[model samples]
Target: MRTLIVSEFITLDGVVDSPGGGDHPHAGWTFKDVEFDEAAYEIKGREQEEAGCLLLGRQSYDEFAPVWPSMDEFAEYNAMPKYVVSSTLTDPEWTHTTVLRGLDEVAALKESDEPGTILVHASARLAQGLAAAGLVDRYHLLVFPVVLGSGKRLFSSDAAKTRFTLTEHAAYANGVQLTVLDVVR
Candidate 1:
């Protein structure tokens, strides 16, 4: 069966908003303002390659469409199949992109027996929904150090009640920690 993996860069206080510089409530980036570590960037590149399909929320898709397509580094990610869960976005600007209409179809997608990966990038609400529905297979949370106190958080509502078993962990050179978690039922 296909794995629904949620990979997010979170802060020490569980803030996952605007880690990549968005116009939302989180304008502050956890990493350096514009600069990036080559090695770390390569790791992210590898992630996009390993994941067969990209599943995103409309806000994330719209925010990414304008920027990622323009960058030479993100060419692979831009070309991959992108499925956005949106009610307002009828025609997405990105190539190989489609808008998922309802949860019924998502239920089927989650239950499919495909042997590839489907990754959810930065859709906190959708992620929460999927988590509640028990669709997510694995969670990869890349933790950062700085705390924003109050911004966009990955887990709030029922997500706070969600439990996981720490399976694997690795800390990168940039003070970022990669934690692999298995959903505990």
Candidate 2:
């Protein structure tokens, strides 16, 4: 079975929206508010090295599809097979991209014989759904120090109780933290 991992850049107040530039008022908070630290971002490199495929929500896919393909840092993800969970997205222009109808398809993908990590990037809604459905195997988070008081969060308040064990953690000089948690199942 494949391991499904949700990876995100979040804030102290649990905000996961607009880490990169966006239309939000607090857009670009990640780069603007926090000091840059290469060590804090090492987890990203490790994730790229370990990931077998990419899974994204429609919104995230819309946001990333155009940009990630051209970015050198995201080359691995650009090359890997990508699955976007969306009923509306019929044709994905990104190379090796496929559209999944819903959670059932996602679950089936998890149960498939492909035996490597399915890394989920900036798909907050999809991550929340996957968590609620108990499909997520692990989470890799880089917690930034700044908090945008109002923005979409990674976890929903109505989500059911879930438990996780911290498999790895590290603190960087810029106060950014790396936390890797595995679902307790």
Candidate 3:
């Protein structure tokens, strides 16, 4: 079976919203303390290399579509097939992009006998639903140093209590914590 992996950049307090520049008051918070180096890019590249496809939410797709295609660093990500979970998105402009209506479609993807991982990036509500449904197989979180107390969190109050076993962890010099976890259910 294919593994559904969630790759998130979260704050120490669990806030996952708008790690990139956006309307969130703590916009670009993830970049505030960390100094990007060769090792950071290597870590990111390794994650992308493990994924055969990119699974994203509507908002994440919308935000990434315009920028990633233009950047050389994200060429591998842009080349991979992308499935965006959304009920409202009809037409997607990105290449090799498909719009999945809901969780049913996501489940279908998980059931497929694909070889590599289905990497989910920066999609909080979708990730929550996937976790609640017990569809997520693994989580790769790059936890930043700062805390944003008021933004949307990775796990909402109403989220199901899903336990995860930490398989590996690495702490970068820039105070970034990289954790690899598997769902314990």
Best by TM-score: 2
Give stretches of model 1 more than 4 Å off.
24-26, 33-43, 113-115
Q: Rate the local accuracy (lDDT) of all candidates.
A: 0.77, 0.92, 0.87
Cα-based lDDT at residue 87, candidate 3:
91
TM-score of each: 0.86, 0.97, 0.95
- The digit string of per-residue lDDT tens for model 3 on 1-185 reads 78999889888999898887887987988776567645544557887888989999998998999999999989988898999999999999999999999898989998898767999999898888888888899988888888788777778798877788999898878878888899997
Once fitted onto the true fold, the runs of candidate 2 whose alpha carbons sit more than 4 angstroms away are none
Alpha-carbon lDDT of model 1:
0.77
lDDT of 2 by residue, 1-185 (tens): 89999999999999898899887799888899998888888888988988889999999999998888999999999888999999999989999999999999999999888856999999889999999999999999999999788888989999888899999999998999999999998
lDDT of 1 by residue, 70-106 (tens): 8998787788878888889998889989889766667
Ranking by lDDT: 2, 3, 1
- Candidate 1: TM-score? 0.86
